[model samples]
Target: MKQHFFVLAALCFAACSKEPVLPANIPTDNPALPANSFTTFNIAKGNHYCDKTAVHVFSDSSMSVKVRFDSSCIYKTIDPGNQDDINKLVGFTEGNNNHLHSARFGWRWSDNALRLFAYSYAAGVRSSKEIATLAIGQEAKLRISLLPTEYVFAVDDTVVTLPRALRSGIANGYWQYPYFGGDEVAPHEIIIEIEEI
Candidate 1:
């Protein structure tokens, strides 16, 4: 009887303890997106990739999209550096069948903010840079413009530049979708809504 009392007391204490502070501007609930125009990407818990979407060939000078993330975007990584790992946002490969030479916008939740980035690979070499920070539940305009010698990433009003691997030609590759992980799968399910613009 005494042991049961202690266990119940402990449970009560845990339940009444204050919860940790969360980031500001977090959405309390997921918002609906127009199904006809917006494509929802869901990364399941313990998974690295989102549910398969229609595969499409891409050959464009720039890829632009409107992205909205929910409260589920907030997460803690096991490794500090993993927080820096940018998850694929939207992008395409450059050249035919050359994923090693491609460009894309990436995103992650780190430092209590939703951060976007310019991520790419050139001749099998990878590079990434923080482009902008957005709030949860806010729709952000993200675009990656291909240039002769560089790739420009623009998010809303912020612009960041990165070197392009394949210059002087349009990006002719397949489209990339949302993916989670640096070395770890998503700790929980994550949902991202995107619409090409």
Candidate 2:
């Protein structure tokens, strides 16, 4: 009878001590994928935000990440000119509560190819510059360096610089993830594989 009671207590403790489960939509390292370092971000159809919203505090002078886009990134917009509108890639919002004081790498499928851009906002003003064109399914290294007066954005061989609002310090904020659309949500489900290097 004592053995039975002990067994029941053990089982109850085991049941209550299980690890917490993450939501199904959160981005996680999939062993099935060829590279475990890569995290696949999924943006559902008709949604501007990706499934992953994991927050990361960043206070570094530079951030670098490698990203790859699959065929799902290819899409046509209702308005032809909207094709040039840049979508947020990897970045972080500077200061507090205001995305207007931020810098990020941007990408878009335009002119029959995938292109990367240096996108940013300084003191509530917006600016973007085309950095380079990258091939789909190919990993590209992107880096953003926060400087006293500007931001240095580099994608492989190409580099572009944009103005920085804060004159003298490292960035302090949360990491931003993949996002879609300027005037429209994702045309279809989009999958982007990213690994911070």
Top TM-score: which candidate number? 2
Instruction: Summarize candidate 1's per-residue lDDT along 1-197 as a digit string, tens digits.
Output: 99999999999988896777645654324322333378788999999988854455677788788999999989988877788677787788875443478788888988789988888888877888887888899998888888887888888989988877677657777777788967888989999989877
- Residue pairs with backbone atoms closer than 3 Å in model 2 (clashes): none
Q: How much lDDT does candidate 1 score?
A: 0.80
Question: Candidate 2: minimum summed lDDT over ten consecutive residues — where?
Answer: 27-36
The local distance difference test score of each candidate is: 0.80, 0.84
Instruction: Please write out the lDDT profile of model 2 over residues 81-100, one tens digit for every residue.
Output: 88988999888778754357
lDDT of 2: 0.84
Q: Which stretches of candidate 2 lie over 4 Å from their true place?
A: 1-36
TM-score of each: 0.77, 0.80
Best by lDDT: 2
- Could you tell me which 10 consecutive residues in candidate 1 have the lowest summed lDDT? 27-36
